[model samples]
Target chain A: MNSHDPVSDCPHIAQFGEAALVLDAPGAMDLGAQQRIWALDAALKEQPGIVETGLGMANLLVSFDPDLWQAEALADWLHDAWVRLPPLAIEGRVWEFPVIYGGERGPDLPFVATHAGVTLEEAARMHAARDYIIFAPSVTPGFGYLYGVDPALVLPRKKVPVMVPEPGTVSIGGVQATIGMTPGPSGWYTLGYTTRFRHPFDPHAEPPLQVAVGDRIRFVIEKVLPC
Target chain B: MDNLALSMGNALLGNPDHAAGIEVQTFPMRLTTTQPHLVAVTGAASAFLDGTPLPPCWVMRLEPGQDLVLKRPTTGARSYITVAGGIDVPLVLGSRASDLRNGLGGHEGRDLRDGDLLPVGPAPHSTGAQDFGAQPPDETLAFTSASDFLDIRVVPGPEHGVFTAAAQAAFWQDDWLVSTMADRMGMRLSGEKLTLAQPTELRSGGILPGVVQVPPSGDPLIQLRDANSAGGYPRLGVVIQADMWRAGQARPGTRIRFHRVTTAQAIAARNEQRDLVAALRRDVARYAELPGFTR
Candidate 1:
């Protein structure tokens, strides 16, 4: 059920409430660990009494019918399943997005450049240097957090989130980078704006999102606006 | 959704409990209808049709051009209005809920504005008698609460033990005041600064509705329907699913006290609520037997 070996670390599984369970993989955020989580997510959905499963960064949230299953029993089952499950290998498509860095598009570009001891051009280059992997669905539908950001480019998310960030905005928070699927509050530092991006979500579509988890995204430097 | 109020409102009108309805918040909501309609108002708010007061949870007939006003509730914060036929908003993702966060569903994906005309679905051939009355859930499925505090039942969350003993004690015992900064997303509470026994970085995980998460500021936030899918704050407790409606009806400046309950107790409470709705559906069926009301 996985593309890699079974995860060696034991997951911390606990009852969130009467009907939900939260499972946290040990150690830091790792692709291998997250892959295992994806495997678990898919497997649990097939189980009876499981209502829904939500994906998080190296974590999984499961909602179940309390009348059908108890939390203790479910937690025990999840532990056994983790040991038997392997990392899920997703054959995902690659998407390329053109982005404009700095100026009004990216208000925090200068701050990022100054903090990283690099010029604005260098900062933009560093951000667009590598491909990013779509980890999981974020706080909202369709959108997801991207991994593989350069460690030096990482910064803690804002203590308080801004009321609104423009839709299709490209941003970085901690070691993760993401693009805004909709305009909403966010604590991430805006780095650029995706240019002429296609609609990523559609409620009418059978499969709502254009991009799937485990997909790869490349941000191409379309234009760099000066601050 | 305010499940109890919404369901009860529809039930009073001989409609299925799942029918879509208008959710009025902090109301002084007024609507003038152009077509005859059967309507019911549920929750704590009172309603008036053309200056005539209707009892709480009462259903009545509204003629064309009649004015219906939902008065601001002195206690609870929200109300529900159900028509004989559901509100005919185009369903997005199998729901009529206005997803304010994503701006994707219901009434052009935004809040209802003045001059907006809401379309109603076709009603059943027979819509039961008008001027019908039923007991409100607040009176039937009531929870014990003090005059100054709303008592909400909660189940200890996964990270409940991470908080210091004093913090845990204060969480259940103290009457936390609901802050002004509250909305569909969540209600922030101000009270004792809940601290963890040892500071630890928590990976962001899925957030459930009714989860009481503690931010760095130590204030507790009870996540609601529009909350983000995930969060990193440490969760102290979750308001039991059965009591979420009570929390939903709590207005700003209201004091809330969390009552800890076991998983079994939470399930029992949920079942009790379900039984009430089921019984109400059956009880309201009698009006359908009235001559000329047969479907």
Candidate 2:
């Protein structure tokens, strides 16, 4: 496939307020659309006058200085850039994490299993079976939106988000999965916990977090240590 | 625009070796300068230099070892402090602004803490103390009070039609209170619960600072500077960039009213704000050339 083929599916680009231009892809949360969004973001970052680029699951927000570049100029630039954008090849690192599932680590295991109409053990096995891709960072720092969860495990978000106190708690909301970096309110059902995850916001640390968008993540269940 | 005006005013006052901008939240904080430098404070009116009352939105020279203490604001929630040059912090992602979430930029990528030492950039050879005072026009300041309910203008968002008729009416008609959850990330507004006609499952998409997101709970959240780049909630409208300053200045418990505006009106408002900053820059330049100006 030609890398510079204009993505075939044209995205709807709209002016967001005064300083930003949002590019909305055709499909919601589709991997192809996400990749296209990333490609657009990468291309826009190279253009002049673009102050910042923000990523959504399937959209991109390009913020520019109005004094430096006009909205119409930016929109035109985007069209040209999108046509010349290379194939989305995000060179990302693969990270392996040892997780403790069920029992004390994940109180919502039974609830998730019951919702999926599967045994608790089977649910844990199903969750750990696949390698997930980091879609994007969502809500907070260090929190990644992991994709590729088993379809059966997909659950609706909680009506009232509960404050999950434990950091590194793995949870699922709808079709998305995330690892908690901080003790905060979440609507996702907790499935496990991992100590390997690090806080993404350390001033002294270089690159902050272990994971980045498009990175592959594999969660392995830790072996029980007999006392 | 207030930030740009203060930075320009500080430049005109002569010292170019100071932080061009200072982030002053509501809480009181102190900064003990190691050297005498020219500085300007804008936005909030409550700040002092070495125990003497310092005027807001004006340039003043601080002596070496003088402590600049910013107290709780009387008018605005955030204050901008500009030194001659600008704050000296290693740029992260090409910006001097601190990203507290990612722990990047500014002084160690975090809020200014006690005993945290910061470095200042080098000043231009012509930079020195000058007795020049320039202030931005009151109309340009855009500081809103917690007592006086804020009227923020908004433009229709992409998903504005997803809201129910009653929800749409309530969004503009009902008075929304800024909840305690307000911060750099976003402001959670409390008011009449705005329910959609039907449950709408939106795909997460690009979000801007002023986008008004309606969550499942029906409360509206206005995204701010540090808000996540994207969100999944249905956005009814986005506050115009011209009036975002009002949202930023409004403290918790402040009443807010949303006024729908046309896209053309939003653009005009933004242009008007830019004009004010440009006008203020000219005024500062003219004042600096006065004969009595001295270090």
Candidate 3:
């Protein structure tokens, strides 16, 4: 969601463990915060000895190898980087991800539309109108949890949800729209389906991933790409 | 491939970081060596060398042609082997640990088997804790055939407020048993169903290693080493990093207890683990000037 004010606020960086740090803010999803977190994350990836980075709503966890750098050194490095970023602007990418909504493909779409007081067609139209930012990967590997749910269709997700959804299924759980990469149960709204997502485990693939944390995404209506 | 330790079912080993090693799930593994090496075995079973009882969780020196057999532990489900100077496996992606979910990063993307001449990495400088005069009783853990059981401690999660008060109370009062389906990804536990307060739609949340989350199924899944990058379920607690090493040893049917602590306590516990690792690394550093490292 690329709005100036997110539901949450700027997060202060804190230690997650002896070798990990949590850069957390209490604010809801905001485009500015997400972009800021991504820029720092991108920079850290090039730096040596980072174990892995775990990005979340209002926080970006930087886990590193402590055998090489002391905990204090890592903390200082993160603090300095978070404070001294050379202004990185969010470069919006226009991507038309194909989707087939409704039916078994998206059983939850009609219900979601009805719950939000929007016509089924209007729900699809409004969803496609704005250029959405792919914020972060959800619980499932290829699931892209997105921001900017059209106010007309913003509603809570199912209290009890399906445990497993097929891979490449586009889903919206809450205001966030995400794409499932693997077959597992999920409570996200089944908005549509797509084939653009990569599998969760591909060893030889470089970047071995289809999307990044701050990439921009849009939905291309089905009938264009046949399954 | 004479006799390989086989898995009647799936075998679990809790190596330090779950390094690349031989998984002797089915008994009668025949390890023929070219040189004498020091090693230790730990987990849910028992082990023997040349028909002599071998130690579990502690290191031992092995001679060439010495036969090492890992008999199942009585009380635990998995065991580990930490060779002196450490095992000589090449670290992929900065970890000697296996990426079990993906299976691309350890011992050529497969577990140990017959005829595999495993490479043992050079030794870390150290005080030889392996020479523990005597190792922690490996047999102590192997008390029963279904020997996988442990009670774990938990610190309330970063998003503990997301769940209702009664849910949190139930979390503390209930007994959670680890599922046999557990692995590197996580230990799925069956216990009192957790209820959410807001049930508000949330972003894919930030998750820490060992953070416990209750999904819509109401079962609490404790995230482990190979957990997803992010999640949205209501988290109940996080297993302190130091204690995490103990958790990897947990077996199915193990009963667990959750104890909430402040962030300060968690931080202190984390540092305590770092200190332990640091001590081990310092011992390894003593070999920095040896022939292998002397350029």
Candidate 4:
């Protein structure tokens, strides 16, 4: 049972809209706080009137029926639940992906390396060093936001996002790393691409997603294509 | 999708409110039916069948080989076209709605190209009825604004109080212009730069459609259908669900003004909308016994 103090003068809880409430822990982005949020999400799913729940990087959004619960009362209930609940340590599986760094698959790999004041080889080495924790599910299905990016590779997202045509594109954003599950616009710096897990999301599949939050992900450098 | 408009379109054809319909956003869409069917067009567009002009929010019986054309809307962005039995695309995840980005559900999970055949569900027996019209919900349940700007009702978000007094005042007072970046995902608004009292980079959190998030750029963005499930930008406010249809109709260059309302008021507005839909359902039920009436 690990009890941690929330960031000073933070943990803003209020109505997200007419039917939803959001509890945002405006503190340091860490695993301990996210674990508590996951615990709260699990506990609230069983409660009556709560229609749905979602996880963000370090925040929780709960959708409820307004007729069943008042906005103020629900907000209060969320505060109480968060304080009283214990952190959940999910026993999840670890997945390793073989990745090819640089070349057309990851057009921004050289830029990312240069920005970090490190060579392309060093950047790839730093990125694959740690087993990042799947922080939360992304906007799309299958892939989730991965925590534990090397500090040297930490950089702000591009001012303008470019369209990444390929899925399974390994990219890095501010203090976090993720894999592109679908072709869409992205502001993150693309570092590499992985073919081992090309399509991670399948609607026809029972679970649809093979990985879940609390799972660990490690990337192995399969090959490096010259820029 | 504009739920109210889609529901109304289905109701006009005597179909259930959740029946699958074609959501048309681009202009001058032309289609030819292989069979006779009762068709209804709801939301912003002028519809015509073989050059015979049809009224707005109106439904008509179309004979096979009769071509239908939907011209660009003058007032709104998207229009919904529903048949009697509804578009029978294979349901994915309990919905026929297309996820164009992910390429799942709805017509091969992609845009409907020319000459593509659509499978429509079985319609009811013909009742000899030719045409029926429904009063557009926009006219009956109108959000009145004295100015040219569209008045969208909103509720304060979680981080609403974190903004400076001036920024908060500007948010309510300023008339924001919808930028060209508007799309199904969200709309970027251009107006007074809203800044927080103390700049903070919030950790990503779950966000829903209609949540107004203010990024570092100071311009506020209104999330809409197909919005991301999560975001990191600080939230300013969220447009009420009842008025989301109106917001969805706003095209680029449309002026918008945010009207603040209490949570209770927002819920009350939602109830009003629900009641309106109920009234529409009852009205459509009267024509259900007709041979041409769909389920």
Best by TM-score: 1
- The 10-residue segment of model 2 chain B with minimum total lDDT is B1-10
lDDT of 1 at B251: 75
Predicted model with the maximum DockQ: 4
Question: Mind giving the per-residue lDDT tens digits that candidate 4 earns over B146-221?
Answer: 4377789999988899999999999998899999999988999999999999977677778999999998789999
User: Which regions of candidate 4 fall more than 4 Å away from where they truly are?
Assistant: A1-11, A100-124, A151-166, A182-185, A195-197, A223-227, B124-130, B145-147, B287-295
DockQ of each: 0.72, 0.44, 0.36, 0.76
Model 2, B1-295: lDDT tens digits are: 2344444444554543234476778478887778866677767676787788776576777777787888997665777777665667887655778878767788877888788877767654432435445454344445333357788889877778888999999998889999999898889999989888888876566687889999988899999877677788888888888787667777788889888887668877777766666666566666655666533
Clash pairs, candidate 4, are B127-B291, B127-B292
Order by TM-score, highest first: 1, 4, 2, 3
List where candidate 1 sits over 4 angstroms from the true fold. A1-8, A102-123, A160-164, A182-185, A222-227, B125-127, B290-295
Instruction: Give the candidates in order of lDDT, highest first.
Output: 4, 1, 2, 3
Alpha carbon deviation, residue B211, candidate 1 (Å): 0.9
Candidates 1 and 4, the one with greater DockQ: 4
Tens digits of lDDT, candidate 1, A1-227 = 23233464678888887889999887678788888899999999889999988788889999999888988999999988888887798878889889999988798999998989999889999999988888887777655878888888888888888854577889998878888876777888998898866778888898877789999889999888899
Categorize the docking of model 1.
medium
For every model shown, the clashing-pair count is: 1, 6, 48, 2
Candidate 1 has a DockQ of 0.72
Model 3, range A29-116, lDDT digits (tens) per residue? 5766666677777888898999888777656778777656665677677766755664356565566677776766777678777877
How accurate locally is residue A149 in candidate 4, as Cα lDDT from 0 to 100? 89
